[model samples]
Target: MDDDSATGVAMTRNGSTGERQLEGDYLTNAQGEDVVAGIRMTKDLSELKKEMPDLYAEFERIALLLEKHYREMQDMEFTIEKGKLWMLQTRDGKRTAQAAVRIAVEMADEGLIDRQTAVRRVKPEHVDFFLHPQFDPAALAGGKLLARGLNVSPGGAVGQVAFDANMAEAWAKNEGKAVIMVRPETKPDDVHGMLAAEGILTSRGGRTSHAALVARQFGKPAVVGASAITIDLTNREMTIGERTIHEGEWISIDGTAGVVYEGQLATMVPDIKDPWLIKLLDWADSFRTLGVWANADYPRDARRAVEYGAQGIGLCRSEHMFFETDRLPYFQKMIMADYPVERREALAALLPFQREDFAGLFRVMDGRPVIIRLIDPPLHEFLPDLVELVAELADLKIQLKHAPDMAAIDALLSDIRQKEQLRKRALSLREANPMLGLRGVRLGIYIPELTSMQVRAIFEAACMVVKEGIDVHPEVMIPLTSHVNELIRQRTVLEGEARTVMAEQGVTIGYKFGTMIELPRAALTADRIAEHAEFFSFGTNDLTQTTFGISRDDAEAGFLIEYMEGGILPANPFATLDRDGVGQLIDMAVRKGRASKPDLECGICGEHGGDPQSIALCHQLGLTYVSCSPFRVPIARLAAAHAALQETGRPHDE
Candidate 1:
């Protein structure tokens, strides 16, 4: 009715209040109702409403007819002015990727889209999303959505929604289902469910959440800040600000865009690759013949990335190897074990586990190059809290006059206290500003054994897999090194043990040693580090962290929201490469590093690996490859194509 600003196409409804339709730049409700919105066009709405009411009615008639004809959601724009109605735009409504493909393919089969259109509809990236691990779609039909947040990662999960992550993990194990991890905000503790969940859903957090980042790292589906849905733990039901559903039920979460849908909606791949992804990479490949790659975290993800045509794996975070349900207790013991002898014993027990993981990885990659980053997070991450241990031990001592497992409890408490002291010392060692802290090289320097054990595992896995007739190529990447000597030291130790092991096995297999150019210093001195290294996998996650001095985990909820909305940042730097700043660093490193060692291999292992923009940037920089999550491999390839074409054509940036 009030159509002063909106580009309303006037139509008569019983001639009571002359309603209008929305055309170019005008916002119309799903039912074509006027909501205060419009874009300026040359059409004269005042004259049209006065002169051509019948034509306007005809246009609305067509929209209704088309909706009936298609039997699905539709979006359209119409112009009605000066006694004439005009059709300006028409397309299927914006839909979930699942619905997008299904509708496209089904409609195409039903003669909606042509053969050429069908081919265009099926995006390689969309297919990758569809093929990845998903929760039991059947289970989610009973639950309801509580909130809507950014779906930074993709996958599925179902469990009794636990307010806390530990309880979520416990309930997941007890109920024998993947966890639906709910939290106001996540911390390092959620890394456990980020490990345990089939998919992750959080009440708080956003695209850069520890939950989101960890999920992306592990290739898990994650929905953050479903603030719309209210979780009531006492009654065990969630209300979507409307209807309420009880616990133990399910809700389907789409991690692509943070939308939660009702029921186990059927899923399909993307019908159309975003023209952006395709066009961007096509531009890159023309400039550089880099072999785009991906960092796969799981078997299915491995295949998905390969299907996207990634040349090889640049980084496979081997720490995720110890996150499996069967492995965490052992991992905890390995971390908390008081003596080196005990730690080594625990690590020895993990060798077979690590070997099996590598075997699976090799099987998935089918012996392709997989550069694995050794264990990264601090030891305290794997251990229980010292405060909790103290409280529990005291509680047990008080509740039971004698005590139950008092010795073990006291021992655990004592060990926790000691570890706390070590943690404090580590924190002191930690940079007051930790992105530059004693994280990467410092951790390796202080805990050389941790790196050694993992190197032994990699070599041992390589040897075993080679015996099984798989041509496995393993590479080792050291994280957070500012100076060349740090890499030289790590490489010396790795090569020495690797040589000794190879001599013992009598199988001459090759492995590459590399350092993550994640610090400004490392990138600046890449030429120096390249001297002893065979490859460089840019860990942009840390590089960006170091560059901006922003803790990705800390900024998502509080400042990033305002920063993005305020236009302080163009896009999420972690999600997309900050081409101007971080990218320049990569370019500098590549040029300088290759200058030192012409044959040195260079690629990326940051979240940017799969980002189309990052892919194009990497290609332009002449790196040998770019690596990303398996799901993003297809997007990267098409993006590579886009980049290639654009590079050669020098097309204007979109």
Candidate 2:
């Protein structure tokens, strides 16, 4: 054995997928980072046993001793000096969510730690990582790998390449194309493109780089510091391994493996429904007092959340139901209707859609409390893009001028008129800032009938489910409430409608009414709002926006990245809770709201709800539940458990 000797490390088992032995290549004359950096070619680690049998045996003995001493899995880095093995370092190993849970439980079974301690050992973020899809091993093996980099985030993505942020954004948004943004390194200016792109590739940056941190927060696949690839920003191209790919060229990136492929490779969705994971969550449940719900809008998502062990539905956004192609026309008609009768007609048509959507959600939830939020976004989202419509209208007018057939000209002229009218209406609907404009309760208050339709749909759906003898706990949640009267006005309409529906159906179904405490005003005045509201579900996405006066969509796309990377902002307030500003508001609201109504339920159903740090904060703030995306339920559950364990100090062994 020598100082420059090739070193090999093997995990006796696949720490990720529970496969057989997982071993890596042996790198000579290089440090550990060199091997992980994928900077040079290497040989198999198993070859070391044959090359140095006596040394390998001693190394094996030391590895076992270290693992036993640590009482946990160890990542051992060692060097051999002239036939003698010297253990350089040993620490708790980095394992995937599956591996972490499996190892922890097995260690507990072996009496190394208690089951509660086992639950505390695994991080919440790892659960989120486990839920992401992985590249198909067979497909990856067959594909031409262009380069390897630091896997900043974990997931797989395939898309046409874009050299810069603008190109990525334009390609994705304007052209309706998926893009993989490639850069020498990303800056705050590239945030917009980063958001639009399916994945990101950088020639330089480490795991904790701005690109990496942002990508992980957004759950986008990203590879950073692939120095093997040379990017030409001006040419909108990148060269890797003697091959050059231009803009729009197809490429696949596996952030988990840190490999970039020449073309789209197949992928397999990893099912986090492993029995070991379920057992891990069950153990988490025993330790945590906080509830874990999901922000599911569809029946499929609701079912998936239940499978993932969600306690209830926190924010079932009703606007998502309108985005379906079949339902968009009716919704657009409602948005563009000139008169109340016309609007009512459109709302009537949309009634069946809402009813069916809610019924399906309730049926899948099977009496799990479902918080149905009324439409929240501005109407323009439901309408055709005004700019695109205007462009189309211009093209049609030119076609009309050149038409040969009289009938064709008439039809073209009619289409032009229709599009022009819609475009005008859409333009009129546009606001300087839609996020602060006619949306949520403002929209509902302006058009009470619109809110009434959603309320009617909810109660009607609940009754339909009730007829099947299934208990239905439907909570009507009004979004974007800024004042107590706002909640009061909506509650009056909602309750009156609910009572009417119950009377009509000849069945009385109990339902609670609530408001989303999204604006700073709402939280500050929660005591007053709670008087009329049955519960408060904090919509932190909007709450963060309103509190900081930064739009969620714009903040990430603009200066927030710089603010974060430059250490100006401590963290992305959108991803992690702003404990000072937003947290204070939440604390005020929770304290006053609960005081106003003793049993007033409180929860958070925002992106931060799933975030491990945010979940811990929510638990500390006395939130009853934390809800996130369907895939994030396990993460939230684990985070809640971690928070509870920390408070109680019951599992301190880890």
lDDT of each: 0.66, 0.85
Which portions of model 2 show Cα errors greater than 4 Å? Answer: 1-68, 75-96, 136-148, 158-162, 165-179, 188-196, 207-210, 233-252, 257-266, 392-417, 420-424, 652-654
Work out the TM-score per prediction: 0.62, 0.85
- Global CA lDDT computed for model 2: 0.85
Per-residue alpha-carbon lDDT of candidate 2 for residues 579-609, written as tens digits (9 for 90 to 100): 9999999999999999999999999998998
- Measured by TM-score, the strongest candidate is 2
Q: lDDT: which candidate is best?
A: 2
**Which lDDT tens digits does candidate 1 get at residues 1-654?**
233222343221111111223232232121234422332234443443344556545755776667556644456666433334456665556544454445444444455444334334445455455546454445445545555788788655444455666766777677677456666567765566556666677677666556766676566777888887777767766677677766555556777657676545444443224443343334333334667777876767777776656667888777777878788877777656668898888878888888777667777676578888876665555555556655665664455455457787676666656655545543434335545544666677877877787787778778877888888888888888899988888778877878877778778787788888888999998989999888998999989988998888776534654576467887778888999999999999999999999998988888888777777788788888888776666666656655665566543222
